[model samples]
Target: MKRFVLLVLLVALGGGGYYAYRQQHSAGQEARASAVAQPRAVPVEVANVELMTVAEEVEALGTLAADEMVVIAPEIAGRVIELGFKEGESVKKGQELVKLDTAILSAELKQAQADLGLARDTHERLRSLVSRGSGTQVSLDEAIAKLASSEARVELAKAKLAQSTIVAPFNGVVGLRSVGVGDFVAVGKPLITLTNIDPIKIDFRVPEIFLSRLKVGQPVSMRVDAVPDRTFTGQTYAIDPVVDINGRAIRLRAAIPNADLTLKPGLFARLAITVDQRLNAIVIPEMAVVPDGMGKMVYVVDGGKAKRIPVELGKRLPGKVEVLSGLTPKMQIITAGQMRLRDGSAIAIKDKPLRTSQL
Candidate 1:
């Protein structure tokens, strides 16, 4: 009887332990199910889409040029006697630049003047004789012709003498000289280069499709690799009337004030012309945009969940972009932590929402 009681007690203890173990296991599984049903929110940064001023711009690559440029050459062959200005110096309009030997020309002018004086005396004598009826009409007419020829000769000599001195046609800077004193130069030989660059020009071409939007006096902004830190502003002053048949582009020219002479001709330039502008246009931070297949997308937080939105983009600005569609003002756009986000995924605000003013 003692042994039976011991065995029964042992079996009852084993059954109670097993029942407790099963109860604990069931409770643990229930806890795991509840945890799976609720997901942790993803932390993300957000910004508000707001209306702001946006510009419609056209961009093109161009080359810088001088407003006025010319190659200075002699009009007549002569030996250079004097150089009035130094190389690479500013010259005023009508300033004397070069002087040639005028000895031969001066002698010819003197001879022509003497001949003119003699001709005038002879003509007067013939006219007086004619008035007295002593000279024939044909003789008086020949004297008059001689007087006219003398006058023409004198004028020709003066013109030739004037050509010995070369003057600047306009206010500009002179380049290096190719001839020195006592060096003989033929007519039309390039002697120097003169350029007017205070108001520089930029030449660029745009596709024909933009012709309707282009106009004279449109504002243009330019940048160059030589002057990387500065941005130059100017206005469109000219457009080619004819389009380039091969490229289908129209050429444009802009004038930029270069009083400091920092910008030089022949430098490569990047240009942006503001063709149009719109106030109260939808704008957003560039970071909020995500590239989708053949399109662009962004995440906007609504009801504490991330909603993927497809957007059409317009002109791009500095660190910002214009949203033409699929977004509105005052919407919270996720700018950060988008890599782990999916449509309708729960999100937690990581920081204060950015406003348009903040951007």
Candidate 2:
């Protein structure tokens, strides 16, 4: 009776375990089947690529420099007697910038003038005496020598006086003052830096590949990060004859008009130089094109599926880019759903494109 009871208990426990396992397995299979039947949520959008002409431009970082930068220095040693211009002052050509002590020079000039007058009188007298044969030839010759010596002294004195006053060489803005009133200055000492700021220069370089397309007098647009919201317009002024051996780039310079003095010297700038103008080029939104490992590609929606098509990219513009090849005038492209798409993946166009109003 004990054995019989044990056997019955064992059978009951085994049967109950088997039934639970079967129920759990059946529930898992149903859940998996339901999940498989449900559709995946995919976000999608559409774009149309149209052929339009786009201008090609090259970009580079550059610096704004003065057209002419000169360091003003004293030519002769003297004590500063007067400060004609202050720091950061604009001066015109030949304007007096600083006055050095000229008291000694002035006295020397007065002496020279007196000597010159005396010599002139003596020379006149000698000439008259020589013509009349009242004076010896030797005496007349001595008088002539004295007159020439006096004239030379006068010239030397005038040169000295001129050197005492420092003048501006050209029209420009002066930098900080290096010497003050009563300060002694030496020859070759820098007084200040003078810079011609009107119509400044922007120096930039372009890749050698653009050598054929680039030309002198091409229009360039410049922007400086130092001053926000301001763009300086300019044109290509010059191009180097030879390419840079190290960088393999061609140096180019542009002249920018700084009428309001908004652009300053030594400020960093970014330049956009239009090298070529395409009359009729295919343009599409930059985001519409996707970059694959091999090359740049874009998906064209045809027969409700994404068709992976490779493209040749050209000049890039703000928010839009130009396609050199692999597109037509009117073709629907997948723009927004690229992240979730692969080759030949099915796509559903969500909403119609927003129409742009023509002016």
Candidate 3:
């Protein structure tokens, strides 16, 4: 009975092994059949990588600033007695903008002058008396010192009286008046804003890596959202010698011509400067780039297959991007249908690819 049971187990194991082998053979045959089927080609538009001249630029957000800007303030506290200039009016250098009441100051100055005159007379009398042996030398010396002190007081009073009037520091336009006639203002209080806006200055910053390419008199172009249709051109007139420690960027200043007086102070501007130009730069259409995680890539149609290649990008131009590496001139890259492409995928060009000469 034991021998019969062993034989039955052996037969069952052999049958199970044969069934497993048959199933494995069938799965292998299906895989081969699937491999024989062709994948559908992705229809795409292609652009050729062209070697051309590209302006290597540094792009940065900039601010439009007056060539010289300041808030006109009074040096001494007083009530506004006169407004020498009107709001929004062009002011010349040394033109008076506001006049504070000088009644008390004038009175003080007159009193000082009177005291100085009295002291001088007294000193003269004392000196004459001393010469005539009537006043002591000490008395005469005291009178002379009093006269000198009085003169100094008069000069101080004159200086204080001059502070009552505020004048334009430069040729600029005056902002709105902050104080009116009879309005009391304190020292250092903002009375109005003075901005010299004819030739405006644009303040911007660029990464420190571009330091070597920056210099005075480099041509740059500026665009502002307020005047979208116009483009203002200027030259970089100054560069900060030191780089900002926190941002690793260097500051720059450009002189923008505002002869027509269209650009105003405090307008937000976009600045682009061509630091260098590459005659052999590999340029591709901006649509050809595929953002992959933190980097960018492109699909090059190589030998009728989609080949994914990572690219290092440089300056961006209108409708195009500079390719620093991972591509060469005359290479065909899928631009339109790259969204449906993968590495080694089949690609069919919807039309003839763009020629390098035409790009």
Residue 349 miss distance in model 3 (angstroms):
28
**lDDT sort, best first:** 1, 3, 2
lDDT of 2 at 286: 91
Candidate 2 global CA lDDT score: 0.87
Q: Candidate 1 — which residues are off by over 4 angstroms?
A: 1-51, 286-312, 325-359
Query: Measured by TM-score, how close is model 3 to the native structure?
Result: 0.61
Q: Report the lDDT of model 2 for residue 176.
A: 91
> What are the per-residue Cα lDDT tens digits for candidate 3 across 60-145?
99889899889988889999989988888888999988888899999999999999999999999999999999989999999989
State every prediction's TM-score relative to the real structure: 0.72, 0.66, 0.61
Q: List the residue pairs that clash in candidate 1.
A: none
> For model 3, what is the error of residue 237's alpha carbon versus the real structure, in angstroms, after optimal superposition?
2.7
User: Each prediction's Cα lDDT score?
Assistant: 0.92, 0.87, 0.90
The weakest ten consecutive residues by lDDT in model 1 span 350-359
The alpha-carbon lDDT assigned to residue 309 of candidate 2 equals 89
Better of 2 and 3 by TM-score: 2
Judged by TM-score relative to the true structure, which candidate is superior, 1 or 3?
Answer: 1
Query: Which candidate do you rate higher for lDDT, 1 or 3?
Result: 1
